[model samples]
Target chain A: MTQALVNGLTLGAVYALVALGYSMVYGILGMINFAHGEIYMLGAFHGILALAFAQHYLANFSPVVCLLGALVLAMLFCGGYGFTLERIAYRPLRHAPVLSPLISAIGMSFLLQNYVMVAQGSGIRGFPMEFGRRLTETRFSAFAGAEFSLLEVFILATSLLCMAGLHLYIYRSKMGKAMRATSQDRRMASLLGVDVDRVISATFIAGSALAAVAGVMVSMYVHAVKFNDGYIMGMKAFTAAVLGGIGNIPGAMLGGVLLGVVENIGIWFLGAGYKDAYSFIVLLLVLIVLPRGILGEQVSDKV
Target chain B: MNITWRGFSGFVFVAALAFAAACGPKGGAGAIRLGVAGPMTGDQAAFGEEVLYGASLAAEEWNERGGVLGKRIKIVKRDDQAKPDQATQAAYELVSEGVAGVIGHFNSGCTIPASEVYHQNNVPMLTPSATNPDITDRKYANIFRVCGRDDDQGRTAAEYAVKTLKVKKVAVLHDRTPYGAGLTDQFKRNIEKSLGAKAIVYYDGFDDKEKFFDPYLQEIKKKDPDLLYFGGIYHQAGPLTVKARELGLRAAVMFGDGVINEQYIESAKEAAEGAYVTFGPDPEKIPAAKGFLEKYRKTYQKPAGAYSIYAYEAANILLASIARAKGTDGKAVSEEIRRSPHESSIGTIRFDGKGDIQGSYYVMWQVRNGKFAALQ
Candidate 1:
């Protein structure tokens, strides 16, 4: 049971990191960023690729340095991808019928998935297991027999830090306030001298960078990355967003952690085959009982 | 325009007939045509490529050796897309092409339904990788498989787990595909029959599409099974094994033949060390296959994967059977295939009453030093 809790928390941390993207994009644009998962997938690919190149070029560099390089490359590449995605697929459809952008989001999701599938053959690839090896060298036991490796601790800590950083940025920073204003009323914010387009693009960049961190952490934890990893991960984070109130940031984090814990507890009783179903079941129950989610005060249905 | 049900049914019937006509194979008197069908595209395409490469190599060699029955053999390829319906269509297309015999439909789900089509047309169908026991249990005389059955390999795995590894508690998990679920069922049954139900600590399943197994691992860790048996393709087994080890579980991991590829070892990295798998006699080990392996490497620039040798032998068996029967007719070739023993790289291939290869056996393999070495 303790082990399940630890596993759930680790998993929930990654899900929350991903959920931030979905929740942030929805907070600002009132549209689901369906392509967020693909950005995460690319992040894993880029991180591993960067690690491989770094190891090859700088053989004597410490593992920490190589990993930091991987993290930076992944974040930069995913941020650029997120920015370009908005420019190409979402920007033009922003002013059309709301349905048009939603459809475009779904289409963009498939387009990115297939593009990656074609680029990387439908095989699982991995970063060197050296990351895991290094991670295992330092570990602490959380409780009776359930040990917490450095990787899990790092994932949780980094995720919390990112969430905290985003929280402070959104509440205290001028640009973040402008983003909040733009999200509130795009026309009014623009009239009040806010660059709405830039705010939306910045939102995508920040959200995608957080997702990239989650992706890199997951790849290292699991020891492999696949082209199709985006779909299920994306859906779970989306569920986390919806469960926490789609446009609420802290709610997204709370929902993600709760969903992961609930899923693990549910899997213990239901078995592993129904692992994916547990999230949906929780989503349904939440939708039926708490329509506005745990932290959500009311259903605005609009940004 | 309002359409009546009767009119719709007639339209459907006509359309079906026309579609059948379009897919029917054309008769070729110049070349003795042979067909290969498998998932040329999709997730399982690598397996299909194995069948294609090995079978094509066999045909190339036979043609170089003055062709079968004085006629140069031509190989026709079809993509089953790993689907039963597509396999059935490929079967019908192969029959229509007047191919003497076929060597395909890699997955058990595809092989089972598609073999019926080959049976109806009296064309011999020899699968290279499909291993479900019911595949040959259907008693189709035209159906044969070069690979060993799930039951055979599963029994081997169970015996290894009990008698060799000497593990007290065992947990079996499958991916819920026809191959995975079927193999797991057989493995569980054999384990229970040998060691009793209490010896088997836990049994469960997971969808093949699942990305993470930490939840399952955490729960299984509580049970403290010493041996974890995975019944699935390498894609899932590789990561599952890695994740299990990551959680500090010291359980010995074992799997079926689906993970024979070196890619499994690569993906699992150090975690793959000490893992066990059951497969047909290592083709690379047999002295008879040394030349074939060398030729294959020379041509393809890669080591022959698991099913490549099986496919080569399937092709050899089919062509030899056709030659022995002295015809390009499907019924005659199929009869010869069923009736006589033929020599090939694997060995003297002879079928049992159920059309499974006679004396088919599986050997254990272990990942040691990043390579799958045969475990004696």
Candidate 2:
């Protein structure tokens, strides 16, 4: 039971970070950024490439430095990717029918997925051992039967830290206020000199960076990365986003944690085959009463 | 509304494209074209490339000896993308091209349905890796595979678990793929037969693309089974093994032939140590295979894949049968292949009535120091 919860939290933490990005985009553009998962996938690949470079080409770097370096590199790369995606893919189609942008998002997702597959051969790329093997091998017990590996600890701590940082950025900062305003009313925010374009760009960058954190952690935990790893994860996080109320920040987090716990517990009762089915059931049951999601109506999460 | 030169040119171009499609590359100018089909361009491209390269090597060898039936043997390749619909399309295209026979299809799901298209068209289809029993169970005289069936591999694993490993309270998992589900069902049936129904504490199947196994491991951790069997490919198995060990799953982890790829050990890393898998005896130990292995390395400038040798033997047997039959007739060539006993790199090949190889054996292998070694 203790192990299940910890595992759920570790998995949920990554989902929350991914949901945060997903929610931010939906809140601002009023469009689901289907390509967000692809951004996450790209981040994972970049993280591994950076980690490999640090561990092999560079000399005498500590594992922490290498990891942090990978995280930063992944964030920057994906942050730019998100910004450029908005400009090239989303921005041009902004004035078109809402469905047009949604379709564009889907197209962008495939484009990025294929781009990664082409750039890096479609083989399952492994992480540097200093990071992947050494980390997972080192484990510490939480209680009598509960053990948390370094990879899990890293993923949980990093997700919480990123979430906290994102929360603060959205609430305590001026740019965050601009974002909230834009999500509520794009034209009005633009009329008020908020630089809605800049605010939207910032939103995508922030969401993408958080997704990068999740991506890097997942690749590290699994010890490998693949081109299409993001598709399912993106969908799962989107479910989390919808459950918490599509655009709600805190809702996305809560939904993520809840979905993860439910999935793990579902396995406990139903067996492994029902793992995915449980997620849908949770969404349906929750939507029956709170359709917008648990935190769907909250103002803070809209940003 | 007006008929212009531009419209006329576009119409003419479209007509030309259709005409070209209607008659594309007929039998490579009098050569006996053997179609090579698999996912040559997608996620499973590696396996398809192995089929191509391996069959190409066999074709090159046969050409050197004097082409099949005094005609140069030409290899025609098609990309199935490991999809059922695309596989059938590849099969249709291959049939339309008037090929002698096909040696391909890396996945059992693709092979199963694609075989029907070949069967209906009367083109012999022999897969190198597709291991589902139904592929042979259909007893489509036109369909066959070089690899051992899932039931054979599953029974071997179950027997080893019950007797050699001395394990009880088994947990079986599959990825719900035709291959995975079929193999897991066989393992479950056998394990239950040996240890009784109550011994199978947990039996379930998950999606092939699923990444999380923590929940399943959590439940299995509680069940505390002595043996855990996964009937799936390495991508899911690797992470599942890593998580199982992480959650302190002490059961002896076992896998079917799907884990033969190095990616299994690569992804699982140190956690893969001590885990067991069932597969054919290592090619490294086959004395007859020594020359082919060496030649494969020398010719390709790379190590042979898990299915490469099987593909080579499959192609060799097919070509040799075509030689003996002295024709590209599907029924005659397939009949000859099933009837004759040919010694190849893997071993002596002899097909039963259902077009299955005789004496196909599965051996237990353990991962030690990040590599699989056949248990003595």
Interface RMSD of each: 2.1, 2.4
lDDT agreement of model 1 with the native: 0.85
**On residues A122-142, what C-alpha lDDT tens digit does candidate 1 reach at each position?**
678876766457785477877
- Inter-residue clash pairs, candidate 2: A249-A301
| Residue A76 miss distance in model 2 (angstroms) | 1.4
Against the unseen true structure, what C-alpha lDDT does each candidate score?
0.85, 0.85
- DockQ for model 1 equals 0.48
Superposed by TM-score, candidate 1 places the C-alpha of residue B124 at a distance from the truth, in angstroms, of: 3.8
- Sliding window of 10 residues with minimal summed lDDT for model 1 chain B: B21-30
Query: What would the per-residue lDDT of candidate 1 be over residues B1-376, giving only the tens digit for each residue?
Result: 3578889999999999888776653334567888999988665667788889999999999989989888888899999977778989998898888787889889887888888888888888899899999989988878898889999989999999989998888888888878888998999999999889997777888887776687777667778998999888887788888889877788999999878877788788888999999988877778999999999999999888788988998999999888888886777777888888777777888898888988858989999999998976
Candidate 2: docking tier: medium
In candidate 1, which residue pairs clash?
A: B25-B96, B25-B97
Q: Which stretches of candidate 1 lie over 4 Å from their true place?
A: A97-107, A292-301, B1-35, B39-45, B62-102, B113-123, B320-332
In angstroms, the error of model 1 at B324 is 5.4
How many steric clashes does model 2 contain?
1
Q: Mind giving the per-residue lDDT tens digits that candidate 2 earns over B18-75?
A: 8876665343466789899987866566677777888888999888987887788899
